[model samples]
Target: MTDISVFPNSLQKLVKAFEEPLPNLEAPPGMPRIKLNEVIGKVAYFYEKLRNSIEFQEEHLLRRNAIERILRRKILLENRNLVDARLLINELIRARYLPNDALPDAIVGVVQNYIDRYIALLDHLKLRRTSPDDRRLIRWLISVASADIEERLSPSVREDALVEVMYATIRNNLVLPESIPTGQEQDILVYLAIHRALIKSDDAILRYHLFRWAYPQWQTPDHAVTEQIKSHFQQLVEAIERRINHPLSERLLVICRQYTIPFLVLADVFKERPGEIRELLTSPEALNDASEKAMTKRIKSAGSRLRRTTVRSIIYIFITKMLLALAIELPYEVYVLRLSNFLPLYINAAFHPVLMAFIGMSAIVPGKKNTQLVVQAVQEIVNPSAPRMVFGKKLKPRPRSRFRVWLFNLAYLLTFVVTFGAIIRLLQYLEFNFVSILIFLFFLSVISFFGMRVRQVVKELTILTRRENLLLLLLTFVSLPILRVGQWFSKKIPKINLFIFILDFVIEAPFKIFVEVVEEWFSFLKEKREEIS
Candidate 1:
């Protein structure tokens, strides 16, 4: 009875606590009632708050047309070169599109006059109060613009045509969420679509984009600017509320003020600094102090230890690959006969030089000190003239690994011999003539390909001479086995088929995953090149 009573109260509190970020929390034990309900409630609350916020913002924008007179005057009177009228109209349209809480980076292009005028109003209450008469003027100007010309066409037709043109332009330019941007130019266009959702106070769209980009974890930081931008944003939100209250809708004003502030600040910064806007909006890093970095390194090392013991490593891969080969089960000689028919022809292809280069690289880089030597020596910023590795300092040679490679080759060959020998004895025991020859041959070929590919991957991982080239070759290695052997063995084999099935699946899965990783890596590399150029 006590346990049952305690559970409900505990759950209610849990639901409340879970309102905060779940990933940030620590779990001890036991499920809470609130946690059970939290998943649905958070999502519901997110939409509800966003919806209410939008409706309230729309009401506020209508109320705040008091500045339209000054805006129009500023636009009409300013020289097009010094203060483009297009900029003012665009800024207003953008503010309406971006979220009241978040601003698009495009605001970085607003003219100093508009910025100064708004900032002046912020600092002076008397100036804003005196602005009431201008509303009358603004109303008269709108009336004139809408009035039908005595000698010309009707006002309705002119307005209709303008509306149609704008509609066509919007449709032509708009980007939906699913579209993959082709270049940085598209980032601007996509940002405009994002801003429209923001203008309506849609956190849902914002969160979706965040998830699509893989959020903070996936983004690589350029200047660790996101945190700075985020912090400034929080401060901007607080400041707007303190300043803009009592007249219009507070929620709406708060949203618009916050939404416009970031882009305005960014635009102002870029007006003088020029390319700095990219550094703030796209960069993903949250800057850390030295202590934080040290702690992170320690955590990664600990996690690596867990993965090695609990998650498996090189030894596991070697055993698993061998098991997969063995599951195909064929005679030693027959498998060899089939493979020898194919292996030499393929190995002799131009790919052999590439493979030998990797093998030779593995031999060159052995010790930890020598590994650092090659990396640092490659770049003089890291190593001075006469070349040093590891922080521009002197480098030591890694002891040769040829001996290690020779021993590995010897052990591997002997293992093949012993496995065939065991198969021979098993065949004799069963009086199954030629069974050992057939089975050993099949497994030997399969294992040999798997082994060579695994070793090549290890070589690439351990020796980093040209990572991109290494990546390209890994594709060939991954595809070769699948094309060569995927059709047979697993599909053909019966009885105890699970091992072969699993093995084949694992082999193919890694390559597909690698291709995806390489694609993202190339994208990141391309973006970096843009920054450099």
Candidate 2:
């Protein structure tokens, strides 16, 4: 009660006005609109109260709760319910509430400090679950303490929160959630303000929004976000141009590299802001349409490009394998006499078409292929939406009996080593020469390594279970020598193209047809879905 009396009369009156039922949007009969001087004076007095509450109070949580309320009232007046402020603070200087140029800066200072303290308290409670009852009480205190911070601040802060959540989702390779906002116009002002703040300051949190926006894959950056990225790149280039000396240029180059924004990469970013940015900021529908089109184009092109690369890679592999076989066989014929008893075994092991055919066929299966179900499973693992019960009676930990673990480990090792040893022994039993056995193993290595790469790409698309992980680990041991051989082979034959002639008639035609069929199927499904909707 004593504390209430200390507030300036204007601040006290403003608080009372908020507590009263909201007056009509138009001022009540003769209840004249709030004077600009009164509003400014109240704001000044309110800031002092907020500062004192946060700085001098021993009850940190209570202090934050108080400031939260006061900040909400200021935000409401500043934004004027997301419309223009009718009460002009421009007259505050004449009224002597504040100096001529200091009003706006002072407002920003007070509001920013309040925001900082509120965020600090939030940070302290990170990763800890607050009970629903506690959350409701806190929210009520905040709402009743000030005005509606929940409604006013929520829209502004929500876009940033959505972006952060989306970043986490995509960075972890999860599917985008339907709950995320899809290009709302209300987010535009908040995004621009956040970006402007980022440019003027070195806050890591602010800088991260820019960083995340730069990647177009996960979420398409809006016009405002794109403009800011371009601005950042432009500033970087101008800084490089200002530095005349070689040392300065080198430093600039290092800085550019660290930021992952090279001059060459940014060359076209400054050509022009897209028409999307040129329009009124209020026009979000057009922006969203353009973004959706770009995303569709990107996804479509990726599939086609992937098909083309796969075809080319297959052709390359076929020719390389034939050349490698000839390279090994021709030299042996010249150096050794024909009387060797191992000649038949060597020929079967080194030049058998069946073995080569099997390796080529592996491409058709391409293990670890992605499906919708697999993607959703990975998404759930990364970001489950349901609340988990944490306060139930403590459960016993899963038995980690070492004997069972050791037995499994022992069996895994024996199976791996025995399978590998059996292959070598079979080659020897078949009377394959040491050279022939080595060549056979080299081809096997190539197949294993290729399979490993395919699995790795699939792993990026879906999380693997323990069994799959163990299988991949076993393959890695076999693939290491093959990967080395591939490196050596690449250096030896830097370029080759004979497979183009042979495979075009066999593999290439079928692969192209398959890709076309897939594309057609996707188009048909999309058309049907749109029609049904």
Candidate 3:
């Protein structure tokens, strides 16, 4: 305060100006002395206009474009695109374009048309590959559209929705390379940018407007173009899954997979009620908003599935525990035979019919055979891979299906042993005569396993006949039926057999619990591996 007299007159005026500083600015450090009051006022006015235009105001395409232009220029400048004073000229141009005084209301539509045409032009690039300048224009258009879209960014969406939006963004971005500015391709890219940023925002309503423009036609779809885009989409999903660094990344990968992974059994989804496929994929809340009755029915119908998911999940868990328990409970040979017996059955029943139906599906519906195929096809998926590529590859990993795997193991071992050994044991039990019951039991076991997998199970398991796998399977076949025969004797005998029956019960309970535990544990691991691969 005492130093005012020592300073030059111009410095004195600046000091005075600070006391009555420009309405929107204080003199910044290192700024040269200049009449920047008007400049500050204009800049503040422009920013106020920008904030109001895209998000706060009705989302007129023109106002959106204007705000985007401002953001683009600022972003460019912040990125150090200019090395000279021309940035000043660009700023002046911006100021002129978005002046403070309200423009006439009718002029808004004209500006909107310009904005619309600009956006449309950017969207037309994917099919019309062009030169560098054209690509630059496309990038510029996208940059602007992104600016418009992000004006509404907020934390209003559910974590799941956020995950989906991020996944959607990542999939699209995976295709875009850094040196992507090409002329004829500009429109296509700009279109992509608009939608990418649009969905990223948390606006409750604006998101739908953004999506309707980009989807089906603009954004690459898995369904329509199966070859190029499908593989690419799969790759994108895999890459995202691998590269996920955040918790939400998992959900993102899932959403990406959901879109890329075609429902191998969509007919099952449609079986409930005549409902739009979109309703299932989209929010049920949105569906409810459309019709309360529809919502109630939809929820009521899904209630069974929801309950089943919980119950099945619990059962799967139980089955898994039993499998683990068996590793310790049974002898090595018994384990082998039991596992082998079940695996073939598992593999056979797992994906047999559906795989067959998929292989031989004909548009012309065949005769009565169609029903058989449909029944089988329906069972297969409730019963296996990539609808698209994942990060340049399309390998689908089988999760540890403890239940299915154990079933296959059982099938591999039990079929022949139950059939052949039961007969030998029955001959001893029936006064040296092999009876029909033993033959029937043996035959029944064999037929059951055989019926489940005539083709796939046999094909895959034969290819996977590891020595350890075989050894454990062989043991189970010998042990399980002996246990069964012992139990039969215990049950048939008089009071003295009570101790033998108890012994048999002990053997069976441990075996059952062990199988169930292992089944669930393995399934959990398999699911984890599947997600990664």
Ranked candidates, highest TM-score first: 2, 1, 3
Candidate 3, which segments miss by more than 4 Å at Cα?
1-268, 271-275, 284-419, 432-438, 441-443, 446-533
User: For residues 111-185, could you state the per-residue lDDT of candidate 1 as single tens digits?
Assistant: 343334323322332222235554433333322221211001111222222222222222223332333335543
**Model 1 TM:** 0.19
lDDT (Cα, 0-100) at 243 in candidate 2: 26
Of the pair 1 and 2, which is ahead by lDDT?
2
Error at 447, model 3, angstroms: 6.4
- Across 81-113, the per-residue lDDT of candidate 2 in tens digits comes to 221121112222222332443233334343333
Error of 3 at 473 (Å): 7.8
Model 2 lDDT vs. the true structure? 0.36
TM-score comparison, 1 vs 3, better candidate: 1
Between which residue pairs do clashes occur in model 2?
A: none
Per TM-score, the best of the predicted structures is 2
| Ranking of models by lDDT | 2, 3, 1
